[model samples]
Target: MLYGLIICTITVIIMSTVNIGLEFGKLDTEVFLIILKSFPIILIIAMLLEVLVIGRIAEKLVHTFSDNTDGFNAKILFTIFFTVIGMSLIMTVIGGMLGKGISPDSFGSLSHWPRNFSIALFCELLIAQPPARFVMKKLHLRQEDKLDYDFD
Candidate 1:
C-alpha cells in the first residue's frame, strides 16, 4: 500500500500537470484548478489499474527477463520499465476519454500515446519509483528494527 500510494501520488500529480498544460495550452490558476478537480478520479483509476493489471504484468515480465544472477537494480529496472509502459499505454486512452468524453476525440486519443508514454516513462523511471522505493526501503528497515528478536 505504501509503495502503491507513493507511486500513484507522484504519477498522478506530474501526469495531471503535464496533461492539463497540454490540453489548456497554458497553466493558469484555472488550469491548475482543473487539474486538481480531475485528479481524484484519475488517481483512483491509476491505482486500480496498477494493482489489478500493470503490477501483475510487470512482475511476470521481470521474472521472464531477469536472471537469478541479476542484481536487485536490474530486476527493479525491468519492473519499472514494464510498469511504466503498461500504465502509460492504458492511461493515455483513459485520460483522453475522461477529458473529452465519449466522442471522436476520445477515440482518436491513441495518437497522443507516444508523447504520453514518453513522459510517463521518463517520470516513472527518474522521478517516481526512486523516491517510492527509497521510502519503502526506509520503512522496511525501520519495521525490522522494531521487530522482537526473541530467538533463544
Candidate 2:
C-alpha cells in the first residue's frame, strides 16, 4: 500500500505533466494549475484501482508462474510486469475520460492508446518504481530494527 502510494504520486505527476503539455501543445503556468485541480481525483482513483483490482491480479499471476526457487527479484519483476501492464491499459482510457468527457470524439483518443501505454510503461520502469522501492526498503529496514511506523 505504501509502495503503491509512492509510485502513484510519482507517476501521476509525471504523466499529468506530459499529457497536459501535449494537450495544449506547450507547457505553461496554467498546466500546473489544472493538474492541481485534477491530481487528487486521479490519484485516489489510481490508488484504489491498483490496490483493489490490479494488485490482486498481479499477486495471483506471480504465484502461478513463480516456484520456490525464484528469487525476490523475480517475484518483484513479475509483480511489476502485471501491475504496470494492467494499470497502463485501464488508466489511459480512464485518464482521457476524466479529463475530456465521453463524447464520440473523445473515443478517438483510442488511436493514441498504444503511445500512452508505451509512455506509462517507461515511466513506471524508469521513473516511479526505483524510488518507491527504495522507500519501501528503508521502511522494511526500520521495521526489522523494531522501529514502528504508522501510515494511518
RMSD of each: 1.8, 4.0
Q: Per-residue error at 100 for model 1, in Å? A: 0.5
**Which candidate number would show the highest lDDT if scored against the true structure?**
1
Clashing pairs in 2: none
Q: Residue by residue across 56-97, what tens digits does model 1's lDDT show?
A: 999999999989999998998898889988998889889888
Structural similarity to truth (TM-score) of each candidate: 0.91, 0.86
Clash totals for all candidate models: 0, 0
lDDT of 2: 0.84
Compared with the true structure, model 1 gives a TM-score of: 0.91
lDDT of each: 0.90, 0.84
Model 2 per-residue lDDT tens digits across residues 58-130: 9999999999899999998888888888887787778778778977666666776777767877888888999
The residue pairs that clash in candidate 1, if any, are none
